[model samples]
Target chain A: MLRDITLGQYYQTDSLLHRLDSRVKLTATLLFIISLFLVNNLWGYVMAAAFLAVCIRLSHVPFRYMVKGMRTILFLLLFALVFNLFLTPGTPVVRLWKLTVTKEGIRMAAQIAVRLVLLIIGSSLMTLTTTPNHLTDGLESLMKPLKKLRVPVHEVAMMMSIALRFIPILMEETDKIMKAQIARGADFESGNLIQRAKAMVPLLVPLFIAAFRRANDLALAMEARCYRGGEGRTKMKPLVYQRRDYMAYAVLLLYFAAVIVIGRILPI
Target chain B: MALKLEHVTYIYGADTQLPVRALDDICLEIPDGQFIGLIGHTGSGKSTLVQHLNGLIRPSQGRITWNGRDIWEAGFPKKELRSSVGLVFQYPEHQLFEADVFSDVCFGPNNLGLPREEVQKRARRALELVGIPEALYGQSPFELSGGQKRRAAIAGVLAMEPKILVLDEPTAGLDPKGRDEILGQIAGLKKETGISVVLVSHSMEDVANYVERIVVMSQGHILFDGEPRQVFRHKRELEEVGLAVPQVTDILHRLSAAGFAVDTDATTVPEARDTILKALGGKWDGPAAGRGAMGEKEKC
Candidate 1:
C-alpha cells in the first residue's frame, strides 16, 4: 500500500532526451512551461499538446507514468471545472434548477483542465528523464551569473540536491515507522475524522523526531566532510555547455517564433 | 501449529515493465515456539517474506496458511492475524509517540478493543516482560535513553500478546551489553510465554548463540533452513551466498586446519575448547600438565 503512491518519480532509461545535457533539458522545460501559458487559443493548445507528446516520446517515458502525475491534480481539475462552470457568466447551454451550464463556461473549463493536465505531463516528463542531482546541477550552472549579485545560487542548488537525495530515504524511514506502529496496533485506517486525525499523532510525532535526528546527523556528517555552504567548492562533474546544447536552444527559439506566427494566422 | 507459505510469490509493480520479484515461490513452514533466525543481505527478500506471516503483505501468487487454514481466503480478519504475529521492525523506537510509556504500550491492547481493565493489565505485563520498570511508566517515551526507547517499543508489540513475535534486526546499533540484554530478554520472553520467535539478524554470532534454527536467504530464495550446526556445516555454500558461518565455528575450522584437532562443528567457545583438548590428545587434567601447573601455582 505504501509503495503505490505516485511520487512523479523518474524511471531510469536510456533515450535521446536522457542523453541530452541536463541544462538543456531544464531550459527546455522552462520554455515549455512558458509556451503552455502563451497559448490563448484552442489551436495553440493543440500544438502545445502535440509538442508535449513528442517530448514524452523522445524521453521514452511511459504515458501511464505521465497520467500518474496528473492524478495528484485531479481534484484541482474538478475544482477548476466547477468554478468555471458556475462562476463564469456566459450564454447558457442548459438551465437546471436555478443553475445555468453555459457553452463558453464549459469550453473555458475544458481549456483550463487541458492546460493543467499538459503542465503536469510536461513537467513530469522533464523530471522523469533528469535526475534531481542533474536538475540541480543544471540550475546551479544556469544561475552561475547570479553569483555577481551575491545570490548564493550554488548554496540553493546544493540544498535542493541534498533534499532530493534524502526524500526517498525519509519515505522509506516513514514506511518502516508506520509498520512499527501498526505492529503495536495503531489503526490509521478506521475511525471518524477526529479519530483518524488523533491516530496521525502517533505517526507524525515519531516521523518528526526521526526527521530531526536525520537532519542533525546529516549536518554533522556534512561538516565532517568539510562542506561549508557552496563557497570554495569544486564539483566532481563540472557542467560544460556543448555545441549540441546551443543547437537545442536554437531549435527552441525557432519553435517559439513558429508558435507566435501560428497564433496570429490561426486564431481560435 | 505452524506458519506455512506454500509457493508464495510476490512482485512489486508486477504489471509494469520493470516488475521487481520481491519473493519468488517461497515455501517454508515455521514451526511453533521455536527460535528461528533469518539471515540475508539487503534486498534479499527477507523482509518481504516475514511481512507475509502476519498478512501485512499478501502474496500475489500462492497461499499463506496458519495452522492449516488459508489466511487470504475470504473473510479473514487481517488485523487479528497481524496481532497474532507481531513484527518489531528495525529502529522501532521511531514508532513511539504517546505522552507516556504506559499509554504507548497500551495502544496495542486498546487496538484489540479489549476491556479497559484488561488493556491496562496487558500493558503492565508487556512492560514487565520487556524489563521496563513501572517507575518509568509516566515518563515520556521520547525522553528515554536509546536502549530504553527500544525496550519501550518492544513492549508496545508485546502488549498485543502475539503468538509469534518477529523482530527484524532488534539488536542493531546497540552496544554489546545492550544487544545481549535485549536478545536475552527476547529469549526469556519466548521461554516464559511459549511464543514462537523469529529473529532477523546479520550478526552470525547472535543467531548462532540464540536461535535453534537458522534460515539463509539469497536473491529472493530460501537457500537453507536447518539447525545452526547443520547450516554452518556447508560453509562453502553459505559463503557463496555472501554469508559467513559463526565466528566460533570459523575459529574452530581454522584450528582444525592448522592440525590442532579441533572439531569445526563446535559452535560455541566451550565446545571448541573441548574439541581442541581432544585433538591435542590430552584430557582436561593431563597427568604431566596438571602436576607442572600445580607446582608452578604453589611456587607463585
Candidate 2:
C-alpha cells in the first residue's frame, strides 16, 4: 500500500534524455522551471506547454508517466484552483452558498493549476531520467563556485547522494519488517486512526533500529574504504560539454527569450 | 483446507520499467495439518511465495484459492485471510513495540474487532502457547530477553487463531538455544492447534526435522514439490539449484557408496544408524557406538 510514492524515483530507460550529460539536463531543468514562472499570459503559457510537449516527445519518456507524476500533486492543484476560484474577487459569473465564481478568478485558477502541474512534471522528469549519483555529481559541480566561500558544497552533495541511495534500501527493509510484523498478526489496515498508528509501531521500531544499524555499518565501510570526503578525488566519468549539449542549451535559451517576449506583448 | 495456487505469477513494479518477476507461474497445494518446508536460495522467490498465502501480496496473474475460494475475489476481506495464515518472520522480535507484553500480544485479536474479553483471553492463550508466564504479561515486551521477546512476538500471531502458520527463517540469527526454543514452541503450537505450518528456511536439516512436505524454488520458479524424501532424492538437482539435502542423508549416501549397506534415504542420524546397524546383520553396540554415532552426526 506504500507503493504510490514516486518522489525522486528514477525510471530506467534507454532514451536520449536518459543518456544526456546529467549536468546539462540538471541546468536545463532549472532553466525550464524559471522560464515557466516568466510567463504572464495565456499565450506565454501555451508556448511553455508546447515547449514541454516537444521535450517530452524528444526524450522518448512516455507521456502517461509524466501525467502520473502530475497526479501526485493533484490535491495541491485542486486546492490552488479552489482558493483562486473564489478569493480573487472580480466579475462574478455565479453566486453559491457563501462563494462566488468570477471570470478573472477562474482564469487565474486555471493558469495556476497549469503552471504547477507543468513545473512538477518538468523537474520530476530530470530526476526520473538521471541516476542519483549523476544528479549529485551535477549538483556538486554546479555548486563549485560556492567552494570559494567555504560552503562545503561537495559535502552537501555527497550527503544528498547518500540519502537518495539509501531510500530504496530503506524501503526494501521496511517492506521486510512490515511483512514480519504482519506475520505476527500486526494489522495495519482496517483500523481506527489511533489503532492504525499503533499498528505502525511494530513496523517502525525495527525500521528505526535497522536504520541506525545500517548507518553505523555504512560509516564503518566508508572509512574502511578510505572515503576522505571528496578531497582531491577524481571522477571516473568526468563531465564534458559536447556539441549536442551546446545546441540543447542554445535552444532552451531561445525558447525562454521567445516566451518572455510573448508574455510582455500579451500581459494578461 | 488445502491452500492452492493456480498458476500464480507475481510481478513487482509492473506499471513501471525494471519490473521484477518475483514469482513465475507457480502452482502448488499446501494441505491442512502438514508441516511444509519452503526452501530456496536467495532471490529464489520463496519470500514472494509465502506473502501470497497470507494475502500480503497479490498475484499479477492467476489466483490463490484457500478452501476453493479466490483470495482476491470481490468481497473477500484480506484481514480474515491473514488471520488464517499466520506468518512469523525472521528476527520477529525486532517488531515488538508495545509498552507491555499483554498489550503487544493483544494487537492482533484487537484488530480483528473482537470483544475486549475475547481479546484478553486470546492474548493470554497466545502468551501461554509461546510458553510465556502469566507474571511476565504486565512487563514491557522490550525489557524481556531476546529469545522471550521473539517468542512473544510469535505468540502475537498465534493470538489471531490462524488455521495455518507460516514462518520465514524464524530461527535465523539467534543463539542455538534460542533456535531450538522457537522450533520447539512451533512444534508444540502445531500439535495444540492442528494448524497447517509452512516454514521457509535456508537450512536443510531444519526442514528435515520439521516439515512433512517440501517445495524447492530457484530463479523464481518451483523446482520441486513433494514429500520431504521425494524432493531431496534428487541430490544432483538440489545441488544445481543451490540447495542441499539433509547432511545426515549425505553421510548415509557416502557410507552406502563405500560398499556399506546403509540407506542413503535416511533423513536423521538415528534413522541412519538403525539402517546401518540392520545392514550389518543387526549388530548394534552400546554407549561407545552411540557416542561415535553422535560424533559422526555432529560432523555431518
Candidate 3:
C-alpha cells in the first residue's frame, strides 16, 4: 500500500515538455502560479483552464497522473472551499440552522477551488516531466545569482537532490521493515488511533536508525571520493535553453497577458 | 504443514503504465521439514515468492494454500499464517529496534499475545538457539557487531516458532566466516527442529552445501527444481540464466571434460574430493600395473 505514493516521481517519456530546458519549465511554473492568483473573473479562469488543458495535452502526461497529486491535498482543498462558501461576507442566498450561503460566497468558493486545483496540477506537471537530477540542476542554476549574496546555493541544491534520490530508497526500506514486523505477527491495521501510533514505534525506531546509517555511509563514501561540498563541480549534461524553450515562453506570455486583460475588463 | 502455490502470479504496479510481472504461473509444493534452496539472480522474484508464502502480500493472480486451505480465503487467520511462516528478510539487522536484545526477540512472541512467561521463555530459547550469549541479552541491539546484530534479528523471527522458516539472502553482506556461521546455524536449526526451510540465496556453493533441494528461478519462472546434484548437472542451462553451479561441481565437470575418469555429479566439496580420490586411486594402480583395463572399466 505504501507503493502508491508518486510525489516527486518522474515519468520517463520523450515529449516536447520533457526536452525543454528545466530552467524554462521551472520559471514558467512559478510565473503560472503567480498568474493564477492574478486571475479574478470567470474569463480569466476560462483562459487559465484552456492554457492548462493545452499544456497537459502537449506534455503527453496522463491526466490521471496529474490528478493523483490533487488527492494528497484534497482535505486542504475542501477546507478552503468550505471557508469561502460559508464565511465570505456577501448577500445571503440561503439560510438554514444558523448557516448562510451567499451568492458571492458561491462565486468566491468556485474561484478558490479552481485556483487550488490548477496550482496543484501545474506544479505536478513540472515534476512529472522533469527528472530529479534535472530539477536540481535547474534549481541550482536559477539560484546561482544568490551565491553573490553569500548564499549556499550549491549546497542547498545538493541536499535537495540527495533527499529526492533517497525518497524511493527510504520508501522501499519502510516497506521492508513493515513486512518484517508483520512476519513477526505485529498488526498494523485494525487498531485505534493511539494503538496504531504505538505500533509504529517498532517500525519508526529501526527506520530512523537505518536512515542515519545510510546517511553516514553516504557521507563517508562521498568523503572517500574527495567530495568537497559542490566546489569546482562540472555538469556532465549542462542545461541550455533551446528554441523550443523560447517558443514555450512566448506561449506563456500570451496566456498570461490574456488572463490579465480578461481579469481587468470582465465584469464580476 | 505443507505450503502449496498453484499457478501463482504477481504483477507489481499493476494497471500502471509499466507493470512488472515479478512472478508468473509459479507452481510449487513445499512440504514440511524439507530444506529447499531458492536461487536466482537479482530481480528474479525470489523475494516476491517468499513474501507470498506468509501472505505478506496476497497473490495477484492465483491461490496460496496451507494444508489444503486457501490462505487468502475468508477466516484463514492471517496472523497465525504469518507466525507459522516466518520470513527473515535480507539485511534483517536493520529491523532490530528494541531497547535490549532479549526484549527485541520477545517482540514476536509478545505480538502473538502469549503469556509473558511463555514469551520470555521463547525469547531466551531463541537467543540461545541462534548462539547469542546470555551476557549480551540485556545489551542494546544497536551495540552489537554486524554479525551479532544479524543473529539477534534472526532470533527475533525464530522466537515466533514458525513451522516453515523462509530466509531471503540471510547471509548477504557478511564476511566469509560470518556467512558460514549464520548458514551453519540455520542448517542446524532445521535439523534440530525438523521444520521446513526455504532459503532464498544467490550463492550456489552455500545452497549446494546445506539445502537438499534447489529451486532455480529466472525472469519470474521456476526454471529447475530438483536435487542439488541433479540441478547442477545442467550447468550450461543454469549458466544461461546467469546462475553458476557450485564451484566444486564446476571443477568436477571440468575434470570430466578433460577426459579424466572422475564423477561429475558431486555437488559438494567432500563428495567431489572423494570422487577425485577414488579416480586417483584407480589411476595409480593402472599405471603401476601397466594396465588401463581397470581404469577404463571404472570410467564406463
Candidate 4:
C-alpha cells in the first residue's frame, strides 16, 4: 500500500519524449524550471501551462498518475500560500482583526501558487519519461564538469540509482514484516495516536535490521566483484546525444525565449 | 477440528485494470492431526493459500469454514480463528522484535490476553519444544545463530498453541543438516502435540520423507492432492508445472520403466532401496547400505 505513493515513476510506454536522450530531457527540465521563475504575468503562465500540457501528452503517462504524489506536497503549498498571502506590503485587499491581506500580497501568492504547481509538474515529467538508470547517467554526464572539483559525480550518481532501486525492495520487506507482526496478534489498526506510534516499534526494528543485512550483503557482493570507486571506470551503456535530442534542445531554447518575451520583455 | 474452503477464488487488485486471479476456485480441507505438504514453484499462490488458512486474507469469492461454521459469518470471532490456525511465515526470523528470545516468544500469548505468568510459561515451553536452550532464553534474539533465530521465530507462533500450524518454507536457505533438524523438530512437535500441520514448501524430497499427503498447485489450480505416492505418480504433469518429484521417486520410476520389477511409488530413499533390493533379489547386507528408515509412520 505504501508503494502506491510512488513519486515521479517512469511510465513504461514507447513515446517520442521517452525515447529522447536523458541529457536533453534533463536540460529541458532545467530550462522549464528557469522559465517558471522568469515568467510572472498571466500570458507567461499560460505559455508554461501549454508547454507542460504538450509534454505530458507526449509522455503517454496518465494525467491522474502525474498528480498522484502531489497530495504529499499540499502542506508545503499551503505554507507558501499563507506566507505570501499576508506578508507583502501594498494596498489593503481585506482586513480581518489585526491581520490585513494586501492586493500585492494576493497577486504574489496567486503567481507563486501557479509557479510552484507548474514547476512540480514540469520536473516530474522528466522523471516520468526517463528510467532511473538513464536519469543517473544524464546526471553524471551533466555533472562531469564538476569532477574537476572532485565532486565524485559518478559515485553520487550510482548511489542515487541504488537508493531508487532499493525503494521497492524495502517496501516489500515492510509489507512482509507488517504481515508477520499482524499474524503475531500485533494490532496496528485500532490504536489511538500514541498507541499507533508504539505499535510501529515492532515493525520498524526488524525493517532496519533487514535493511542493514541487505546492505552488508550487497557491499560484500560488490567487493567480491572488485567494485572499487568510480576511478577510471567506463560505462557499459554510454550516454550519447542523438539528432532528436538536438532538436529537443532547440525547441526548449525557443520556449524559454517566448516565456521571457511574454512575461518580462513586453508591457503587461 | 476441520477447516474447509469452498470454491475459494482470490483476485489481487480486483478493481484495477489488470486483476490477477491468484487463487481460483480453490477448495481445500484441513482435518485434525494431518501433516499436509503444499507443493508449488514460485507464484503458484502457495503463500496466498497459507495466508487464507489463518483468516489473514479473505477470499473474494466463496467461503471458508472453521470446524462446521463459516469463518466469514457475521458473528465469527476472527481473532480466535487466527490463533487457532497459527502461521509461521517464510524467513520468519525477521519478525523478532523483543529484547530477548523469551519475551519475543511471549508476544503472541500476550496478544492472546493470557495472564503474564501463563505467557512466560508458554514462552518457556515453546522455546524448549523448538530446542532453544534455557540459557539462551534471556539473551537477545539478534545474538542467536541463523537456525536458532528461525526456530525461535517459529516458537513465537507456537506459543499461541494453535491446533493447525502452517509453515511456509521453514527449511529454506539452511544447510542439509540444519534443514533435517528443523524438519525433524516439526515432525516431532506434531507427534507430541497432535496438532495438524500444513507445510508449504518447494522441495518434494523434504516433504516426501515427512508429510502424509501432498497438494500440488500450479497456475492457481490444484493439479494433484493425495498421498505422496499417488500424487507423485503424475511425475510428468508435476514436472510440466516446474516441480519435480523426490529424487528416489524419479529413480524408482525410471528403474520400473527400464524393466525392473521395482515399485515406482517409493518416495523415500530407504523405501526405494528396499523396493529395488526386493526386485533384484539382492541381499544388501552391507551394514552401511542397510540404513534404517528415518521417518515414522504418520497416523491421521
User: Highest DockQ: which candidate?
Assistant: 3
| lDDT score of residue A83 within candidate 1 | 88
lDDT of 4 at B209: 89
Q: In every candidate, how many clashes are there?
A: 0, 1, 0, 0
Docking level of model 1? medium
lDDT of 3 by residue, B1-300 (tens): 899999999999786778999999999999989999999999999999999999989889999999999999988899998889989999999899999999999999999999999999999989988999999999999999999999999999999999999999999999978988999999999999899999999878788889999999999999999999889889999999899897777878898898878899987655666687687875454343433443343223
Which pairs of residues collide in model 2?
A: A183-B87
Of candidates 3 and 1, the better by lDDT: 3
TM-score of each: 0.93, 0.90, 0.95, 0.91
DockQ of every candidate structure:
0.75, 0.52, 0.86, 0.56
Tens-digit lDDT string for candidate 4 (B1-300):
899999999999674446799999999999999999999999999999998887778899988999889988898987788888999999999999999999999999898899999999988888888999999989999999989999999999999999999999999899877898999999999999999999999879788889999999988889899999999899999899999988778878899899999999888767777788899887656635354432322110
Tens-place lDDT digits, model 2, residues B174-283: 88778878887888888888899988997787778777888889988989888877887889899987787887788777787899987777787677767877887766
Docking class of 2: medium
True contacts kept of each: 0.77, 0.69, 0.88, 0.58
lDDT of 1 by residue, A1-268 (tens): 5554455466688998887888998888888788877767877887788878887888887788777667777888899989888767889988878888898888888878888888888778888888888889999999999999999998899889888887887788878777777766678899999999998887889888888998999999989998888778888998787887788889878777776667546856
Question: In Å, what is the interface RMSD of model 1?
Answer: 1.4
As for model 1, its CA RMSD to the true structure in angstroms is 3.8
Ordered list by TM-score, greatest first: 3, 1, 4, 2
Give interface RMSD, per candidate. Answer: 1.4, 2.5, 0.7, 1.3
For model 4, the DockQ equals 0.56
The parts of candidate 4 lying over 4 Å away from their true place are A86-102, A265-268, B11-21, B55-78, B281-289, B292-300
